[model samples]
Target chain A: MRLFDFFKLSRRGPTSADTAKQRLQVLVALDRKGGGGPDFLPLMQKELLEVIRKYVEIEEERVNVDFQAGTGFSTLEVNIELPSETAKMAV
Target chain B: MRLFDFFKLSRRGPTSADTAKQRLQVLVALDRKGGGGPDFLPLMQKELLEVIRKYVEIEEERVNVDFQAGTGFSTLEVNIELPSETAKMAV
Candidate 1:
């Protein structure tokens, strides 16, 4: 093995389990926030897009909205990606 | 009026309603994640603290856990604040 391989082997980088946990956590939050309706997401996305456009440019795909369900509540997660610094400055 | 006062007046910063919306979103997400049990929160908090302590030192108050309920699901929101760069590097 290469010298760097040792570090790679010893160091535990983020695993799929970690990603799954994060996704589940966000999903559960979204589910509990009354997010099951089909139209709600699209409508909310459109409105948010408009509001954000006023400040910075963002693509539709960059805006993610989802919901999750748990024992007693739901969660709605809204992840919006911002433009790069140069892009923002130019806008 | 000061020059900055005009900007402050015209520029609409985040209002209480925006905060409320954000809170409600997170709450709904948490509620849907089956976060209603009082015992669950403390137990989860303890375990999480143990895990995070291995990587970085964090105050108990910096970690916030909550839940919210909605139409068909619940959400569990876990917010953990990390130590500053200098602090982490020192560790």
Candidate 2:
């Protein structure tokens, strides 16, 4: 692979920008594929909480989800605070 | 519904925090369910790109996806720039 390409792959971890992109990607994927049914968002919200609960402790109320528009693409954003020291340490 | 609950639902929009939260949820969903094999990330990246492309114009190279660890939870982030004025106006 080219040097720049290799560098890009190697650098693919937690960065503010990268995190933002991933969030947007997931949101759009769900919005388009999840179907905007009445229960869809709630189901997504429930499923999201369930999935997150497996990996990290979170404040159920503090959790937030949204959709955003940039220059051309729209993003779905998810944010939650971790609940454990061990979880942070594992990362 | 209680006033607090009503406010929460009514206020939900393209807020930055909400967007971030959605991103994290989607990423985790994919990571846990996407089965991170050699092709997983690439497939996710491809699928993400495809989904985003349907609704917005993006800077292909500038597009980014990442994963992050917060207090206890981890997040997947996706970021992309829109290519057309129409996409932003539609939001």
Top DockQ model = 2
Q: Model 2 segments beyond 4 Å from truth?
A: A1-25, A28-91, B1-42, B67-75, B83-91
Q: Whole-model lDDT for model 1 versus the true structure?
A: 0.33
> Each candidate's interface RMSD, rounded to one decimal?
23.4, 15.0
* DockQ by candidate, in order: 0.03, 0.05
lDDT of 2 by residue, B10-64 (tens): 2336655334322211233222221222213333445445444444445666556
Model 2: per-residue Cα lDDT over A1-91, one tens digit each: 1212222332336655334322211233222222221213333444444543543445666466665433322344454533223122111
Q: Give the docking tier of candidate 2.
A: incorrect
- Clash number for model 1? 48
Q: Residue A9 of model 2: what lDDT?
A: 32
How does chain A of every candidate compare to the true chain A by TM-score? 0.37, 0.39
The best candidate by lDDT is 2
**Model 2 clashing-pair count:** 27
